[model samples]
Target: MITGKNYIGSQLKAAGTKIYKTINPQLNIENPWSFIEATPEEINEAVALANDAFKIYKNYPAQKKADFLNAIAEEILALGDELLEVYCSESGYPKGRAEGERGRTIFQLRTFANMLTEGSWLEATIDTSIPDRLPLPKDDLRKMLVPLGPVVVFGSSNFPFAFSTAGGDTASALAAGCPVIVKSHSMHIGTGEMVASAVIKAAKKNNIPEGVFSNLIGSGVTLGTSLVKHPLVKAVGFTGSINGGRALFDLASQRPEPIPVFAEMGSINPVVILPDALEKNSKKWAAAYAGSITLGTGQFCTNPGLLLGIKGEKLNQFIDQLAEEIEKIAPSCMLHPSIKADFNNGKEKIQSQNGVSTVAEYKGEIAPNYAPQTILTVDGKTFLENPALSHEVFGPFSIIVQCKNNEELLTIINKLDGQLTGTIIAEPMELSNYNAVVDALQNRVGRLIFNGVPTGVEVCASMIHGGPYPASSDSRFTAVGIHAVKRWVRPFSYQNWPDELLPSALQNKNPLNITRTVNDIITNKPI
Candidate 1:
């Protein structure tokens, strides 16, 4: 059922001569399907279609949009075993992981759908006219969040389901009334094709406008650059490497009409283990982190790649225990050969650095594309001196840093590049003494964890899945959760406009019956 073609406004087309196929990393062989790269013409047409669709689709009632989203979830679930099989063949992930990610993806879609039905996400506000004011009359002003036109979403390499076609970026954008054009990740083009079909089917069943959703296939930068630089694209959502995300961010910034790019990039999520905690529960903490480090082959952005602890008997014992536990677990296959190569390159780079030593590494020979879990150790002085030590290795690899004192630990935390998460392992009440360390970590990460690993990110209204600088292009906006819809919208105000002419959410009649702020008071009442 995979067409291996571009989805331009619900129609499948393959006019380009260039073609590529996805690799089955588990078997180290190419899949049967061949995908055509999107040409410049196709990209332009898709963008234009999205622009046209946005004019009509942006004004759709919340219920209709919610129906569309919910339908997508249903259609994806209908994909059933075929989807799971293709996902495993293309990405080398096990069936269980595919199912789990599929569940997460469906949950995200439904979460957005429910949010739309609830209808308070727009944050509408109104101030009635004050014609009887003592000094001068004030004009009536009504404001609400409105869609920001078409958005370009670049699928992440690691997360084929949750962050790919019909993923968070697409779901949140459509929920916010913005048309979406997704540049499918080449590694999982077949999976992308299947998901796109489901989305298009849902769109048609719901009578959603054409061009409201598109999935383009391309291997490199040409198609993505065209989409990002297109005059119609008002925003972009990306999840990938720092270089790749930064390039898109730069391209969007340099355009004639600049657009916002919410790019979730690299992170070496750091963990700080307090002395008392290490002394009291070194074995327990070590076992937990060993699992966290190798979870999903450590492809997670929230993987604890760096660990900090005071250099002493307790920290040394914890390190030995962690090394022993990690080596016992077998290595797993990476997503692709390129990813495996990158993991090797990153490990080599870290090992080549002065003062870096391997404390533990999987010594057994593994199949092609399988990554070896590794644990490296380095002194705080060496880690602080060399910025390369902080770079994310992007696989089942971690580095434990031995700090000389509390001051040095705090300094190292401050020096770390922005991260998606920072975890602190401490005995009860032990955190009170390391206020400075906690404060420094707080400033550097989007989320701070206490006595826990940062492996799993919960999807909720409160989760902050972004951070400063390289962790994400914009820390103010999160790449996960319901609030992500805010990234695709902008506030618009109608001054002295007639109630009948205003949008339902802002109209004085309160036809939608949703919550709103009227004259600084939260209510659902009509003016």
Candidate 2:
């Protein structure tokens, strides 16, 4: 059923001569399907249709939008085994991983649908007129969040289901009443096409406006650049490397009317181990970290790339144990040949650095596209001097930094770049003496973990998936959960507007019956 054509507002077209095919990384061969790249004309049509649809879609009622999102979830589930088959063949992930990611994708859509039905996310506020005040009378005012026109979502290379087309970005944008245009990741274009079909089916089933969702195929930056620079695009959502995200961010910023690009970039997800804990639980912690570093072939953005500990006999013991444990785990296939090549190149670059020593490596012969796990060690002074040691290796690779003492460990943490997560492994009473270290680590990461791995990201309201600076473009927002809808919306105010003309959430009649602040009081009652 894969047409290998672009989805331009419910219409399929492949006018461009450019064509490409996805690869089966496990088989190390191209898949049977071929996809046509979106041309300049197709890109323009998609953006134009999205701009036209936004006018009607932006004013849709909360219940209606909720219906559309729910329908999308249902249609995606309807894809059944076909979607999973495509996901596995295109990405080399196991069937279980494909199913899990598909479930997560469905859960995200349904969660947003439920949120819309509650109708309280708008944060509506109103202030009635205050006549005959001491000197000046205040006019009535009301404010609420409104959707930005159109959004461009760039799919991620690692996650085809959870972070690609019909993922969090698309679901949240639709929930915010903004049209979404997805720039499908080339490595998994087949999977992207399948998911786009489900979205289009849902849009048609729910009578949603055309161009409310689109999936465009392109292997390079040309299509992405065009979409970002388009005047009709009001915002962007991206999850990828720092270089890729930075390029899009720069393009958006240089536009005549700059737009906000919420890019979730790279992270090392550093883990700090206290002396007492390592001395007591060296073997246990080492085994656990080995599993975390190799989880998902170390492709997770939250992978523990760097581990810090005080240099001592206990630390060396932990390193030896970790190396042994990591070498035992079987090597796994990466997403694609390019990803495998990059992982090898990254490992070579780190190995070539000064003062770096390999603790252990998988010496067994591996199949093509399989990444061998590696563990390296370095001293605190050398790591601090050569910043290159801290860069993420993006595979089943981790570097342990042996600090001179607690002071050196704290200094290293202070100098580290922003990260998605930071972990502290310490004995029950060990934390009381290292408050400064805890504070510094907290200041540099979005989420701080106590005696837990950062490999899993829970989808919920309390989760903060974004962090300061390089961790994400804006720390104030997240790329997960219901709160993500806020990224595609902007707050607007109306002064002395007629009650009948005001939005339902802001009207004096309380037509929506949703929670709102009126005269500094939170209530659902009418004015």
**Estimated TM-score for each candidate:** 0.99, 0.99
Candidate 2 positional error at 296, Å: 0.8
Q: Report per-prediction Cα RMSD to one decimal.
A: 0.8, 0.9
How accurate locally, in lDDT, is each candidate? 0.95, 0.93
- Candidate 2: tens digits of C-alpha lDDT, residues 1-527: 89999999899999999889999999999999999999999999999999999999999999999999888889889999988999999998999999999999999999999898888899999989988887899999999999998999999988999999999999999999999999999999999999999999999998999999989999648999999999999999999999999999999999999999999999999999998999889999999999999998988999999999999998989999998899889999899998999999999999999899999899999989999999899999999999899898888999999999988999999999999999999997999999999999999999999998999988788888989879999989999989999999999999999888988889988988999999999999999
**Mind sharing the TM-score for model 2?**
0.99
RMSD of candidate 2 to true structure, Å = 0.9
User: Which digits, one per residue and each the tens of the lDDT, describe model 1 over residues 1-527?
Assistant: 99899999999999999999999999999999999998889999999999999999999999999999999999999999999999999999999999999999999999999999888899999999999997999999999999999999999989999999999999999999999999999999999999999999999999999999999999648888898899999999999999999999999999999999999999999999999999899999999999999999999999999999999999999999999999999999899999999999999999999999999999899999999999999999999999899999999999999999998998999888899999999997899999999999999999999999999989999999999989999999998999999999999999999888999999888999999999999999888
Superposed model 2: Cα runs more than 4 Å off: none
Clashes of 1: 0
- Assess candidate 1 and give its TM-score to the true structure: 0.99
